[model samples]
Structure formats: structure tokens, C-alpha cells
Target: MQLTQSSSVEIPMNDAKEVDSVTLEPVDSQSGMDGGLKAWLTVVGGWIAGFCTFGAANSFGVYQALYTLEGTSSASNISWIGSLQLCLIFAMGILTGKLFDAGYFHHMQIAGMLLYVFSHFLLSP
Candidate 1:
């Protein structure tokens, strides 16, 4: 005669296996409209400013050639002018970034705008 024993174990259902109704947050209809307007305004403003400042700088090659002609200025000396300008522009970016990180964007932007206007006026000669 032989005796045999059987063991029974209960398995629990996985939490993910249970199907429950999901509720989604409602979307705001005006959200897209508001964001689009703001984005477009920023893009337009940037384009205007870029064209006025950077676009003007791109025309520097024409001016440099004229300045480097005989009786005006030596090419070697005139080349330094552009180098100094680029150096100053890049250096100012460092300071501006620091100021912006400190939440001084408005002041920095105002100062930059004023400086840009003043420089252009002074160089208008």
C-alpha cells in the first residue's frame, strides 16, 4: 500500500490584468489657439529683429572692400575691425546669458536694444 499527498496553491490575478474603465482629462479647445498666436508673434518679432541687425552685418563684406581701397585704410588694419566686432558680440553673449539666468531678461533685452540702436546711429557717419 502506498500513500500519496497533494498540495493546493492559490494564484492571485495581476493588477494589470484587471480591466478598469479609464478616465481621460478633458482638453481645452482654446489652448491650441492661444499657443499658436504666441508662437507666431515670437517668430515674427525675431525675424524682424534678425533682418535689421544680422542682415545688416552680412552686408559688411561690401563695406569692408570699400574701406580697404587705397587712400581709405589698409586691409590688415581694417580686418581687425571686424575681428574686434565679432569678439565683442560673442563676449556680450556670455554676460547676457548670465543676466538672463538671473531673471534679468527684460533689463538685458532693453539694454541690448538701446546699445544696438546707439551703435548703428554712431556708425552712420
Candidate 2:
């Protein structure tokens, strides 16, 4: 019943003419399946990232209104900016997903935060 390296089992068929062979390997018990502190931390970090990114993007209407009131830009032009922001968010999600699958999640996370902060600094007068 115990499976180890290169361990295989054979089962006899009802007709006793053919046998089916199956190979089994022992599953790693500690392959990050504990769902403990690390899992919860990752969940919370994702929630925070979503809040910072999506939250600001979704609130573009307020910014657009302010811009319109200040007469800095036309309503249509301001709306276009909001649309572009949403599109970039979606497009970047695809790129980021690829990087995540490639195991550069921590690097991307750090780079994203730095970029976010740097952008805010550039935007500040």
C-alpha cells in the first residue's frame, strides 16, 4: 500500500488476460498546503493591492468632476482619461498575471508599490 520512488502496482482484470499498471508517488505534505499564516498574509496583501489600484481607478468620476469644475479640461477629455485608466488596469492585469505565474510575484509587488508612490509624487504639485 505504501508508494515510494519508482513504485508501481498492477491490478488484474476480470478476464485475467490483461493487467493494468499504475504508478504512484508520495505526495509532499508540506507543499504550502497548511493554509496557515502565510496563506492569510497573502490574502490580506492581495486585498490591499486591489483596494489601492481598483479603488483609485473606480473613483475617477470624482476627479473628473473636479477637473470639469476647475475648467482645466473638457468633460469629454476628462472622461477619456478615466477610460484609459480602466483599460490600462485591465491590460496590466494580464501582464502581471504572466509575471506572477513565472514566480516573480514578490518582485512585481515591490516594483508596483514603488511605481505607485513615484507616480503620486510626480502628480503632486
The clash count of every prediction, one per candidate, is 0, 0
Cα RMSDs, all models: 14.2, 6.7
lDDT of 2 at 79: 96
Error of 2 at 31 (Å): 15
Give the poorly placed runs of model 1, Cα more than 4 Å off: 1-34
Q: Write the per-residue lDDT of candidate 2 for residues 8-121, one digit (tens) a residue.
A: 555445655555544455556666466889889989988998899999888888888888898988999989988998899899988989899999989998998898889768
Task: Report how far residue 120 has shifted in candidate 2, in Å.
Answer: 2.3
How does each model score on TM-score?
0.61, 0.69
User: Model 2, which residues run further than 4 Å from truth?
Assistant: 1-34
State the lDDT at 29 in candidate 2.
Answer: 61
As for candidate 1, its clashing pairs are none
Q: Which candidate is the best by lDDT?
A: 2
TM-score, predicted candidate 1 vs. hidden true structure: 0.61
Winning model by TM-score: 2
TM-score of 2: 0.69
